[model samples]
Structures are given as structure tokens and as C-alpha cells.
Target: DTSRPTDLQRLIDGIIDDLIALEAPISGFFEDVDQLKRLRHSEANDYYQQVYGLEQRRQAYLSRLRTQFVTRLGIRTEQLMRENEQRRESIRRTTYGRVEDCIQWVRSRLEKLSAMEFVEDLEQLEGMFEEHKVDNHEIQDFRQNVDESIARQ
Candidate 1:
């Protein structure tokens, strides 16, 4: 007696009211599901197609982000290799020039490299390398010398 057709209508109405009170994204998801149910009609099908296209674009953007990260990592490694090459060239050029002038030239090159994201602790490295504290520059010099010497051999 209490469970009539009106009871079913009240239950449906309560569900609809709860769904309507959800946040925008949840509401949109539910709306899209509703539109899917109505897709036998023409307008609902068109709207669903548009949402599908937007989903595709969102996926493409995510894919592009992944590719870009890989490309940037490759570029960073390439930059490290090129830096080693240039350092060897610098050492060779420095050997033929005055020591003070060579140091200045190296300092200038290091200055240009100051903007690189690879250099996290600039002040600490500068103190370590420029002052011969930990043989940092000497290690770099040795690496350059070895590469150049091996190339000639």
C-alpha cells in the first residue's frame, strides 16, 4: 500500500536532486552519462561527439608533455657532452696563451654557464673550483687534457 508508483517517482527525484548538488566535474560526468543515454536522438549524439573530441585533445596534450620531458633530458645530456668538448678546446687554447688570460677566459666561459639549470650550487662550486680548494677546476682540466690527448693519439 505504501509502496506505490509515487514512491518510485520520489526515489528518482531524490537521486536527481543529489546528483544536481555534486561539484561541477561530477555533475558534468553525470550529465555526459545522461547525454549518452539520450544518444539515440541527434542533438545528444552531436554533444557527445564534441566531448569525445575534447577528451582526445586532453590525451594528446598529456602525450606531448611526456615526449617533451624525454627530449629535454636528451638535450641536457647533449649539452654536457658539448661542454666537455669546449673545455678541451679551452685547455688547448689556454696552453698557448698566458696563464692569467687563460684563467680569465675560463672564468668568462663559466660566467656564461651560470644560467644553466645544471649548476645548482653556484657559490659553493665557485669557491671549490675558482680557489683550487678541491681540485674541481683541475679535474675539469685533467678531463679536457685527457680527451684532447686521446683524440690526438
Candidate 2:
């Protein structure tokens, strides 16, 4: 195999194809992690679980590849898998930070609402929600509560 250049080239091509196939799932996992930031709070947990499942699958596949393929092929697949894991972890941290910020913003808005004049506070809260693009059932329910309180006043 070493003396025959064509046979060696064919072996390299097969290894390259296997490497590309392995990378496809990693790319998909990256996309899923990136998308977590865009999802609403209500949808985040389910999406996170799905992504976590994918990560588990990817880890299992990588472990198999490391043992069965990388060792025999003399490839750098382990390094690539490690880098992907790092990227996934970084994205997860960013997603959690964003979710925490959203929660804090909602809490602060509610606190401000409690201390302000009714009509003015309602308008301000509405504006804040609109500006932040926070359209969720919880915020809507809060707005409805405020409106009912205003009507009673």
C-alpha cells in the first residue's frame, strides 16, 4: 500500500470522507446552540434539552471514532472534537447569561411599575416591553393585571 501511490491516495480519500462525515453533526450542534439565544424563555428549556441530547450523541460518536478510526488513521480528530466541545460550552454560557438578563429586566420593570403613577407606569411598561421585543404570555398577563387595576381606580 505504501509503495503503490494510487492505493495510498485512495486510503487518504476515504479517511477524508470519514472526517467530513464526522464533522457534519458537530456543525449541526453548533447551529442548535446558536439558535438558543433567539428562542423565547418559554421555549428555551425544551430547546436546551434537545441540544443537550445532540451533544450527548455527538460525544458518543466521537468516542467511538477516537477508538476505532483516529488511532488507526493517525488523524487529529480528537483535537477537533475538543474544540467543538469548547465552542458548545461557550455558547451555552452566553445563552444562560441572556436568559438571566431577560429575567432581571422583567423583574426590574415590575418593580418600577409598582412605584409609579398608574397611567404613566402602564404606558412606560408597554413601551419598555415593545422596545425590548418581549412579547410573552407572562408579560401579557402582567399588562392585563395593570389594565384591570387602572379600570378599578
All candidates' TM-scores? 0.26, 0.32
Tens-digit lDDT string for candidate 1 (1-153): 255545644554455344334324543753674455434344554564465455445434433433454343332346435634664575465444434444565686687567544456889768646655434544454454344334333
Q: Which 10-residue window in model 1 sums to the lowest lDDT?
A: 144-153
Question: Which runs in model 2 stand beyond 4 Å of their true positions?
Answer: 1-76, 119-153
lDDT of every predicted structure (CA atoms): 0.48, 0.56
- lDDT by residue (1-153, candidate 2, tens digit) is 234545654565566456547556755764565465445346554554575566556556646555555555555556557766775676566556545555676788888667755455787978866755654644664443344334323
What does candidate 2 score on TM? 0.32
Error of 2 at 144 (Å): 20
